[model samples]
Target: MGHVPTRLLSHPCATRSPPMKERKAIESWLTDMDGVLVHEGEPVPGAPEFVNRMKESGKPFLILTNNSIYTPRDLQARLYRMGFDVDENSIWTAALATAQFLADQRPGGTAYVIGEAGLTTAMHAAGYILTEFEPDYVVLGETRTYSFEAITKAIRLISAGSRFICTNPDATGPSNEGLLPAAGSVAAMISQATGVKPYFVGKPNPMMMRSALNAIGAHSETTAMIGDRMDTDVLCGLEAGLETILVLTGISSRLESETYPYRPSRIINSVADLIDEI
Candidate 1:
């Protein structure tokens, strides 16, 4: 991780080129879950205070995550345990976004799914039939256990002509044991076998950002996306035309962000620094 510059710490709003009124148009916010708010299932320092400030300010915001293993209710409960008081409605996951995409593209379609309750439940709620017999789509999502047999079945199904879809493109995820192969890694294996690339609906795709903004009834021009990773959060927010803030509390660092061609609208030490802005 790169060290945050002292200049950014001294002037939090220095990056905003727009005038005061235009800057004040930023009434909504979207934030990454893992690195921005929590680290390894624990709340980041001052994360709770920042969250409470958002609520008190009455600004529309959503806590976004690419992890598709857990539902909003599950995440809400987890955050509650971590000392943050976020409501389930204010949480959005890749699973929900994927389901929304499928429903829009192929309503009431059948799918062969390889995911846990979060993904499956959303698909079912969208009126999708989950099956293995010539399904309309082959959906992949994160799971605690990835079964070889399931992957084999997915490969066969995709080879047989089902459209391929994945929740996110994360190749690996952090775990207590260490880094573990995630949905993107497994998706690559399946893609290699069937010669078909799965369409990822998560961050860095920009679709996730658009969907999240719509969920909160926020306009991109008036919304700011706060994230830890430049490739995913900042990239997607930029693509979606939202102001992007990279907080140095997770994966990407201040120096690492410079390596990228694009730049965030602002950089802050952490979510802690944004409480005053709220």
Candidate 2:
């Protein structure tokens, strides 16, 4: 992560001038999980405080993640271990968003799922039957161990007329060993085989942001989106009509942000800086 320039704090988009009521309109928040809250299973500075403040303020908020390997309970426990007291209900995942999309599109449809517990559990909850034989869709999600056989099955299923859907567009994920191929990479392989591009239902896609907003019962115009990645979090937030805050605590840097056509509403060093605002 890079240092956020001080000038960015006073940028026009960073904060509304004068009328306190205008600033108070932003009562709810939607934040990316990995970069904004934690890194490598560790809590980012002041993340716990930020969350606690939101909870105490009686404002609705959600921790959003593109990673679909873990369920919300799983994430809650992980964050708890990192000393952040976030409830399971306060988390929104790509898995949940994808499942919601599927349920809305075809209410009781079957699907062949390729992912871990998070993805499977969401689909099952959404009333989607898991099957490999003539299913309605082929859903792809993040997993620690992606089997080649499963990929082959997904390719075949798509070729057999099943719609292709992916939880997120992240091509790689970090691990102790290094970077590993993630959901997007696997989706690419399947697309090459079946000549069908998957409809990604995660970050950088406004649908994901809208779903999260709905989960928290917050309207986009009155909510704030906090994230570290400009390409996904900031871009999606802007598209979803939410105020975007870019924190330089993960993949994006202050310098690189200038190159993007869309800019975040605010740029802070980390989630720590958000405590005073809350």
Tens digits of lDDT, candidate 2, 1-278: 79889899778878776653344378899999898899887889899999999889889999999999999999999999998888899999999999999999999999999999999999999999999999999999998889999998888888889999999999999999999999989888899888999999999999999999888888988999999999999999999989999999999999999999888888999988888777
Model 2 ranges with Cα > 4 A deviation? 1-24
**lDDT tens digits, residue span 147-255, model 1:** 9999999999999899999999999999999999999999999999999999999998999999998898999988999999999999999999999999999999999
Which ranges of candidate 1 are over 4 A from the true structure? Answer: 1-24
lDDT for predicted candidate 2 compared with the true structure: 0.92
Q: What is the clash count for each candidate, in the order shown?
A: 0, 0
Q: Give the C-alpha miss distance for residue 269 in model 1, angstroms.
A: 0.4
Give the lDDT of residue 50 in candidate 1.
95
